[model samples]
Target: MPRRGKVVLVQVAIVLSLLLVWESGVRAGLIDPFFFPAPSTLVARIGEWMSTADFWTDVGVTLLETILSFVAGIAIGTTLGIWLGLNPFAAEVVQPFIKMFNAIPRILLGPIFVIWFGLGLTSKVALGVTLVLFVAFFNTFQGVREVNPVVLANARLLRASKWSLLRHVYLPSATTWILSSLRVSVGMAVMGAVVAEYLGSSAGLGHLIAQAEGVLDAAGVFAGIIVLSAFVVALDAVVDRAEKRLLVWRPAPAHEV
Candidate 1:
């Protein structure tokens, strides 16, 4: 097999072995399943959810909120980040306000959102957007400010106008920071959606988990978590692809830890 294929097979084997051991340990009564669910049980519960309409609706609501919130965050954050990054004076003036908002716990803001937007989808989406916006904004802002002066000078030597400098120099320089923020924002978006649901909502995975918790259905809680994790992984993969496409000009060798 090719190297990548061989590595994938090894990973599959490792995962399967771990699952078997965990399930065996639980079934043999050597391990408790209450706090930690076996992979088999989680899988079975997920399968049951797949067979239900309510499950799909919950998933849809969560996905809708996550997508809308993430898109809004990106639009607002990117624009603000670029603006602040290009203008040091603006950055300095706005620094305290930004810091104050960032310092406040997002969970505290969730309640106000609930009161303002009620138990509707708007509240959940707003919370998610708030959570993701700051992350992207800060990163984009730094990316802009950190553009190399030598590059700007070279662009100036070529008689590049402000528009040309922004397009060619600032944007490319900040692409790294924006992409880094995107990776993190993907998870934050999901978290915001779920937390909003937990506070008060009639549907969605968070509400589902809350209901299951009330009934002491440990397996169901694990099932909801597994679903959310899968959603996060999938969205992160999408962001990774977009980053690769948008920043194709940047050589990969420079990004090593």
Candidate 2:
């Protein structure tokens, strides 16, 4: 088998082994099935969800929120980060306000968002954007600031226009930092969406998990968690592929760690 196939098989084996051990422990009364549902029970619950149209609707709602928030956060964050990077004086003036906002607990903003945007998709997306924005912004800011001073001086000597300098010098240098934040921001976006739904929402996987928790259904909660994990993995995989494609010009390391 190819390396990728071997890696997949190893992953499957590890999961299956753990499941077997967990199932045995539960059956032998060493573990409580009620508190910690068996893998089989969770799988069965997930299968039931897969068979229902409502489950798909919930998944779609969460997926849309995640995507929308991620895109919005990246767009806004990158623009501001680039601007701040270019103008040190403006960045210094805005520093305290940025710090104050970042220090605020994002979870606390969910209720406020619900009040402002209503208990609709808008609130959920807003919550997610808040979570993703800081990560992208900080990374991009650092990337731009870390650009080589000598190279920038050379560019100035060459009489490069602002647009040319930004396009060729700033953006290329910051691409690494921006892409580094993409994977992390995507996960934050999902968490923000789920948190918003859990607090107050009529739909989405978070709502489904909240419902299960309300009824104390361990299997249902576990199923919801598994579904969410799968969703994140799928999204992260797409980001990974995009990062590779975009950074193809970057040279590979001499050795893998």
Compared with the true structure, all predictions reach lDDT values of 0.89, 0.94
What lDDT score goes with residue 61 in model 1? 94
- Output the number of the lDDT-best candidate: 2
For TM-score, the strongest prediction is: 2
lDDT of 2: 0.94
Tens digit per residue, CA lDDT, model 2, 87-168 = 9999999999999999999999999999999888999999999999999889889889999999999999999999999999
TM-score of each: 0.91, 0.94
Instruction: Tell me each candidate's RMSD, in Å, in order.
Output: 2.2, 1.8
C-alpha lDDT of residue 156 in model 1? 98
- List candidate 1 segments past 4 Å from native: 1-6, 254-257
lDDT score, candidate 2, position 29: 90
The TM-score of candidate 1 is 0.91
